[model samples]
Target: MPHLVILYTPNLEAQADMGRLCRSLADTMLAQRDDGGAQVFPTGGTRVLAFAAAHYAVADDSDDHAFVYLNLRMAAGRADAVKKRIGDALTACAKVHFEPLLAQRHVGITLQIDEAPGQVYDGKIGNLHALFAAAR
Candidate 1:
């Protein structure tokens, strides 16, 4: 399972097209491949969620400053190189998406990938996977 969550400052809401960014990021995730050339993430298991923080404080607590934090959570069994590639792809996508905003305003964008050795209690129930499989 790979769920990419994007949290950004509210000030950039008007300037940023988050929906487009989400789709771009999801597409980036779908494009990732392992060294063996197999897909790194399952099609149906990919999810991207974005939220505009209603309350937050950035460096110096200035309203002019904005931040976008992207966290990618996935299962733990990938080579370091694979993970780095995934992170690089996603970061590059975000950077391009926010290029216009970056030029006009002060913004910070960060991407992090998280994976635990074994989740304590992970439960998922959905038919999305079957839908993707059927398409294949």
Candidate 2:
């Protein structure tokens, strides 16, 4: 299970659709075959969401500068190599997601994959994946 979140500056909203961008990432991940990373993107388990930053500062404090951070959360167990592959894949999608803005404006893109503490993370997919998979 993995939850992908994108936190980007509001300025990018005019040029990008945050909602669709996040959905695209999820769809990409869902399409990939699992790389020893438990049941990769099992349907609804791959949740993609975005947050618009109302206030942010760049290194130069310039309005033209922007940033988008993608945080991937999943249960701890996967190997480092697998995580890197997953991250690289997602980051590639992210680049495409913001290509237009990156060309027109100064944009910084970063991605981090974090393992949720096993004890604290809890949830039920509730056959959502089955439903989503059925439609596919």
Candidate 3:
């Protein structure tokens, strides 16, 4: 259960398309599997969400600069190499989404792969995966 959340400054809303970014991230995540295996992430559990920060201050506390932070969170228990590979793939996707704005202004893009506390993280998926495969 990976939740990809994108938080960006409000000023970038005019130039950024959150929906498209989410789609791009989802596609990239789906491409990577454990040891290059074929089992894909369940669509029902894969979440890509975005929130526009109403108030944010970048370096030097200037409003002229903007920032986009991505948090790729998943339940604990994975090899470090596997997690890093996934994180690296996602970072590239984030760069692709923010490059245009970055080229025009002082935009700082950061990405972090966080692991949810396994003890508290609970997840359950219905038959969405089966239905998706049937449609295909």
Candidate 4:
């Protein structure tokens, strides 16, 4: 089972990228929109229903190895395209560019996911939302 951690950009209006997903939970949530809880984006803009899409999780771990996985769902579907769009969004949010239009679309974001596990999960997985909610 993956331990999820939703993340957003500095603007909080745009969705998160792999870099943001790799951040700490506190850093991720701190990126949420100030006005309302949502995932912000640049080209994608602010998505109401789509706000919940930007997230990451601990995909697998053991005594010797572990990895954090960030997954972004996009209409584009192509991994390369998804990577590019997210990169552009991050750059815009980060002021990595001097171009006016590209830079202003940044927004804040929010994360909705599970807490760290106290014990390793080992049996058949159950209701994720319920499990995470209860843990929270």
Provide the clashing-pair count of each candidate structure: 0, 0, 0, 13
Q: Model 3 — which ten-residue stretch has the worst lDDT?
A: 36-45
C-alpha TM-scores of all predictions: 0.97, 0.82, 0.85, 0.20
Q: Give the 10-residue window scoring lowest on summed lDDT in candidate 4.
A: 41-50
C-alpha positional error of residue 49 in candidate 4 after TM-score superposition, expressed in Å = 14
Please give, for residues 34-128, the per-residue lDDT of candidate 2 as tens digits. 56445555676788989988788877857878888888888886667767778888888888878877778888889998898656647574887
Error of 2 at 82 (Å): 2.3
Q: State the C-alpha lDDT per candidate.
A: 0.95, 0.80, 0.82, 0.33
Sorting all predicted structures by TM-score, with the top scorer first, yields 1, 3, 2, 4
Supply the global lDDT for candidate 1.
Answer: 0.95
Model 4 segments beyond 4 Å from truth? 1-62, 77-136
How many Å off is the CA of 16 in candidate 4? 17
Best of the two (2, 3) by lDDT: 3
CA displacement after TM-score superposition, residue 81 of candidate 3 (Å): 1.5
As for model 1, its CA RMSD to the true structure in angstroms is: 0.8
What is the per-residue lDDT of model 3 for residues 1-136, given as tens digits with 9 covering 90 to 100? 7888889888888888888999999989888787758544666568889999877777896778888889988877777888888888998888887787778899888898888765664757578667877876
Clashing pairs in 2: none
Error of 4 at 111 (Å): 17
* lDDT by residue (tens digit), candidate 1, 1-136: 8999999998988999999999999999999999999999999999999999989999995789999999999999999999999999999999899998899999999899999677899888999999999999
Q: Candidate 4, overall lDDT?
A: 0.33
